[model samples]
Target: MKKLAFLVLLIVTVLSGTLVGKAIASTGFDAYSMTTHKIENGNLTNKVTDLISFTSQNIENEKNNDSKLVSINNVSDNVIDSSLSTDEEILQELSRYKDLENTYLMQPGWTSITFDQYDLLPLNSPKPLPSQYRKEFWSHFDGNQKVTEQVDYLISSETGKVPLGVFVNGELTSLWNDGQKVKKDPYTPAYDLYLVSSIQTLVESNSPLELSFKQEILANQSVSLIELRTQFSTTDKQWINIQLDKPVWGQYEKFTFNSQTGLLLKYEHYYVLDDMSLVLSSVTDNFEYSVASEAPSDVTNLIATGGK
Candidate 1:
């Protein structure tokens, strides 16, 4: 009986040690472990919530401008003959535009703009209302520097479906839809206007990717012009970022906004070491709303039907 009790005690001790070791291993000092903890304890969730609240307040506070929808009648609607133009030629043409160096200092406009990925209609689908259509705008500015700019979409009136966010100097400035104050600035309204013009030029020309690339230049941080690397995944039916030859890191080294809706999409980042070497560092960190259907039940059917 004494021997049996000793054996049981030894087994119990071994099991306890195993459990403690596992607990330590699971809570190790690695970033992944810490991230897991943050996710579990709702710290990340709360931070996201706080960010959303801050954005909502900012959108609420934005001064509603009485400006009517100005006619784009003068703007040429001639689609760039993509059939006659090579990608290289299109990119070269886009490169001719001056890049915005310090868009972070751009001023806020009175009118608010928003984008909705869900509003996208298939290329063959019937046309929707102006509000249902996702469009970007470009505005020109002449201040201390000459800068051209673009925004994702602007609704004439409030739409419940519009995503909550604001762009200042081509970068996301606020998340609130009501337009409350999130950040103040030496805000340059002219820069925003320039961007709006640039966007119009690119879109009307049927050069969506070029439009995105120009935005990259305005947002680039480097001595030399950044080299753009683009790729499309047939498996995923999404465009992926392969590389960006910029000096400073962006929010995602590879991913960028959708040219049509300004929505975030899966992108890859390529890292170059020693100025000449290259490597694909990461791919598709975030997935946006489906480029196709929305309903969960529809996903299976869509996939079976070869729709992404």
Candidate 2:
């Protein structure tokens, strides 16, 4: 009985190894250390090469002589083309956020940005309008910044209508709601604009492994997407960081960055449930950016009157 059991286990192990090898071989160049060379005549050559240095001398000899040429094929798009490697594309996207401190600071001139936020519920339940949905506008000019948030909810006597937070040089100066003095403690610096804070930190640290890169079709447009999974830390309320408050079994986030501008186009945060299903906790989208002549008139008036 012992001998029979040993034979069966050995056969199973051998089959598993064979299956894995076949899977690896199916991925083509992605699984092998191969190199493609272009000759002066436009023909191409592919060889199973070592991962280490392939010197200019080798290239010169390959071009000047054909004796060492093992095989040649016509130029094919499926094999090679002029496009940045995946890692290079990731670095290019990261560089966009390297010098960006705020979304409204996309350029030196006056800037304006607007976006909407939605707090989600389990089982994809619907939310009450204006209460669960929020709209925000941020504009910067000269040395002053204005942020206006709109949400309608009544707390006993006070109406949690629109709250206007004003900032100068990136510090929350004052907050007011319809002539009522609102606390500044809750409104941190940059407020909801902190959506990209974690991403900026990851980019600044220059660690590529922490971020996974991919390309996909979103809204019928091509976008470069980056994803990360880890514990989140923030000093104050930020859209993506709030999901950490739960007994999070697992958490991961996906962000799409505009290739040309480096601005965050969209963000989605998900919590992995016990059944390994993803429940979206929050999402922010409808990003708009443009040059502004100045801050909103009402905001400027409030600042001028010293928030009476």
Per-prediction TM-score to the true structure, in the order listed: 0.21, 0.47
Residue pairs that clash (backbone atoms under 3 angstroms), model 2: none
Best by TM-score: 2
> For candidate 1, which ten residues in a row score worst on lDDT?
29-38
lDDT of 2 by residue, 49-72 (tens): 211012233334444765222111
Q: Report residue 208 deviation for candidate 1 (angstroms).
A: 17
lDDT tens readout by residue for model 1, 22-117: 011111111110010101111112232343353334333322432121111212233222331444543443333223312322223212122221
**RMSD of each candidate?**
24.3, 23.7
**Which residue segments of model 2 deviate by more than 4 Å?**
1-92, 97-109, 121-131, 141-161, 168-210, 217-220, 231-247
How accurate locally, in lDDT, is each candidate?
0.24, 0.35
Residue 255 of model 2: what lDDT? 64
What ranges in model 1 sit over 4 Å off? 1-89, 97-118, 121-142, 146-180, 184-229, 232-308
